[model samples]
Target chain A: GAGVSQSPRYKVAKRGQDVALRCDPISGHVSLFWYQQALGQGPEFLTYFQNEAQLDKSGLPSDRFFAERPEGSVSTLKIQRTQQEDSAVYLCASSLGASAGGNIQYFGAGTRLSVL
Target chain B: AQTVTQSQPEMSVQEAETVTLSCTYDTSESDYYLFWYKQPPSRQMILVIRQEAYKQQNATENRFSVNFQKAAKSFSLKISDSQLGDAAMYFCAYWGGANSKLTFGKGITLSVRP
Candidate 1:
């Protein structure tokens, strides 16, 4: 599909292990975003990237949660020393431009991570 | 900080009938955007509709429409001729435009009874 692509639709990790989730945004998209949605809850912003520059990452819960988009086209959300609280569905979205309506995001089927 | 509220945790509607899902928001900024997103079991967040705060007229897309009351800080979605496909988790979101992030409300699960 032409939409955003997230790898490892489901991941199960042991406590204290490290896991990485990948997201491939749509072609020509200038902005990309990451969100975490816990069970029965809405997605909360995690981070954002604009053409290889990580513009904002304040939404990350802790230092254990890190995200990067070195190439601007692909992004990775890595959680170190995972805890039970780290379990959630991570979603990736991309938009074409930076304007208001232009920032309407298209999302990918998120990666559901379970920390046991 | 902007906050969205979806007080209803779940709702059900009969197929071919009409239903309304309520949403309210709190924001100090006058210029912003409101959106409705649907997430099925597949976990894909699909944009259903959007309304700009500056526009006084309500926004409608096909069978979906919104009663956007800016003064009351209320934005509710109305689905006409509901179908089984409409069964999903619906989220109301607010975007301030300054930040490239969306503040979403705890979603409401909607079921379409056939």
Candidate 2:
């Protein structure tokens, strides 16, 4: 599929363990986004990257959470010392990178992480 | 900060019937966009419909439409002749041109009964 692709559709991690989630945006897409969706709640923004530069990351919950799009095409969301509160579905989306904020985002199936 | 509110957490409707989901938002910007996204069991967020605040005419796509009231800051989605495939979680989102972040509501779960 030409859509955004995320690795490890599901991940189970133990407390204090470190985990990394990867996302591959559509080819040529300039904008990538990350979101966190918990049970019964809407997705909250995590971070955004434009090409190789991370433009926005204020949505990240804490310092323990880190995201990087070093090469611009693939992004990784890493968590250090996972906790039960960190368990949620992480979604990745991409856009054509047109005008600033008007482009529609295409989403991936998302990675569901369960922390115990 | 922009905030979207979805009062109804869950709703049920018979297949082939019409259902309306309500959403309200708070924003100070004049030019913005309202969107409704559907998330199925697959966890894929699909864009259903969108409305520009500057436009008076509502936006519609096949069986889905939106009733956007700019003055009241309300944007509701109407699904006509709802089908089983429409059963999913719908989220209302607000996007301002000045802000790159999308503000989303809690979302509503829709169930279709045959």
Task: Name the best candidate (by DockQ).
Answer: 1
- What is the C-alpha lDDT profile of model 1 across B36-104, one tens digit per residue? 999999999999999999999999999999999999999999999999999999999999858779999
lDDT of 2 by residue, A77-99 (tens): 99999999999999999888842
Question: How far in Å is the alpha carbon of B37 misplaced in model 1?
Answer: 0.3
- On TM-score, the leading prediction is 1
Error of 1 at A114 (Å): 0.4
- Per-residue lDDT of A74 in model 2: 91
In terms of lDDT, the poorest run of 10 residues in model 2 chain B is: B94-103
Model 1 residue A63 lDDT? 94
Task: Give the residue spans of candidate 1 off by over 4 A.
Answer: A99-101
DockQ of each: 0.73, 0.72
Deviation in angstroms for A61 in model 1?
A: 0.5
lDDT for model 2:
0.92
Q: Which runs in model 2 stand beyond 4 Å of their true positions?
A: none
DockQ class, candidate 1? medium
- Alpha-carbon local distance difference test for all models: 0.93, 0.92
